[model samples]
Target: MNFIPQFTQRSAGTEAVVSLPHGGRRPGRELLVRALIGLAILLVITLLVWFDRDAYSDSGGDGLTFVDALYYATVTASTTGYGDITPVTPGARLINALVITPMRIAFLVLLVGTTLEVLSNEVRRVLIDRRWRKRMRNHVVIVGYGVKGRSAVNTLHQQGHDLNRMVVIDNRPASVDEANLTGVAAIHGDATRREVLRRAEISKAREVIVTLDRDDSAILVTLTVRQLNPSAHIVVGGREGENVSLLRQSGADAVVTSSDAVGRLLGLSAVSPNIGAAIEDILSSGVGLEVAERQVTANEVGNSPADIRGERVVAVVRNKTMRRFYDQSVDTLQTGDNVVVIRKSEARAEKERSERD
Candidate 1:
């Protein structure tokens, strides 16, 4: 969709023509067909006039035959009234008033309709294109459309979600178009601006991921987003390790050093290949399960891992080693021990219902 605005101005005596760019294929073809048909009809009328010149002349100075009537209709419809061939008789005058006048009116209506249709199509195309750009949900919004930002977008796109809502905000048109083409909503404006955030609908957004090249710009974006919507989880990718803490202090929930994440992944791959594969699968594949950390605080049954009724505990990530926690284990629960539970949708719903009751 073209982001350029269509502007039109009308003066005191001059008519304004708003030339709409060719929108879609169908409407453009329809307009062309209509104009061609109208031209064909006018040509046919002219041919009939040329064939019966004697019949037209029989009425003398008063009567206008087929040729004269045709000529008058053409000139009037074209808005080029030469006044050379005047209708003389009352019959001819009445014919001119009815046929010629109505023909001119019809031509004007067709012209206006075609023009408006094209313009409407252009506007609709832009809206639809914009909608496509913003179709992702629960997505990470990157502030800058730079290399790191682009890589993040590609990774997110590869790691498909139920709702792929990703948006990129940069003050450059080319960057915006690049983002848009990648099926990400790219708004051309300052990410630090409050209005730009408003356009991005930052409040309801799940996560705001800032990967601006400069530390100052990323900091500003993080601050603005935090101020606008405090609850939104903000993640920033920065170069300097020192600035990471500063960005976090400025309200970034998590600061990701691109180098650090890469290094960590590389180190983990060397130490534990299987663990690295699992991590990569979780990050890259939608089907990969996520072992969420849920603290079992309430001992409705008893202060024991085995006594925690309802849901199944898959594993216990204690001392960085995953220990399989069985259902029949009589072991008591520790206060700070992390429980890795396999999330079952039915179990979750039951828990919710029981809590509500």
Candidate 2:
């Protein structure tokens, strides 16, 4: 399915702009500015004609009053030319031809220009939306753009994930604008709705990340997404451990319970700060140390886990099954074994050294 992302509001560069459906907010401001300027011009001309009342003839009434000048200005600018008021003197005729006539034309142009600009913008928005949706496929759909969602996307970006292939769905206008600013496609709507998921092309998505603020909302979103795309990998974040089971039953492939994970970290910190620190270093990206996985080296293929050098080998994978270093079968590494190790993250090596000093 193609993902047609509608841009409700987006800020462009240095300008603070807010666009909306049908007619944008910023364009309305522009129209207001134009209207004010046109009114100012009309006022100035009305004063000029009123001050020189002797230069004109009002056949139906006495010499022109302030009210007549106002009425004449309106009818003249609108090209009504009622003919009751005529410029009898050469000075009045010259002023009407040189000054008043031009301002009248300008007033009409500004009104017509505003209409044309709106039409032009609508066409442009539609074309760009169509083009974006056509190229979307096998992308990643993020249901929320909150703290956890930002972290997840940042980590994926560090791993060289494509931002263009990711779509962010958030109900908050600010969140959607932020996502667009960061060069990601975003949809501003409730993600739990089936139509919204379909617009995000959930059927063709490779993965879906649910990080809503509430567990109940997350569960509803997970169930909806799973029903839409059963084959896609869905990773959900639950604030409480008790909600993890519900999220799993809702069809989330993996559920990360933030409360439980943080509690465990706190417990480990109280017992052994060094162990907790080490675990944190491994979990952190582009910092101190990191956990990485690699295929067994040629020379290390026939060697035992204890014989490997440089990095600490934590586990080995063979035939899709994981075996820890303490496991009997993992003592001997095989040809196709993949090793998971704790090593200094090469990407953050320089930054880490600088910060330590």
TM-score of each: 0.48, 0.77
Give the range where candidate 1 is weakest over 10 consecutive residues by summed lDDT: 14-23
What's the lDDT for candidate 1?
0.64
Candidate 2 C-alpha lDDT tens digits along 155-265: 777767888789888888778767766667777778887877877878889999999989999999999999999999999989999888899999999999988998999
Give candidate 2 misplaced runs (Cα > 4 Å): 1-6, 9-95, 292-341, 350-357
Score candidate 2 by lDDT. Answer: 0.82
Clashing pairs in 1: 136-164, 136-165, 137-165
Best by TM-score: 2
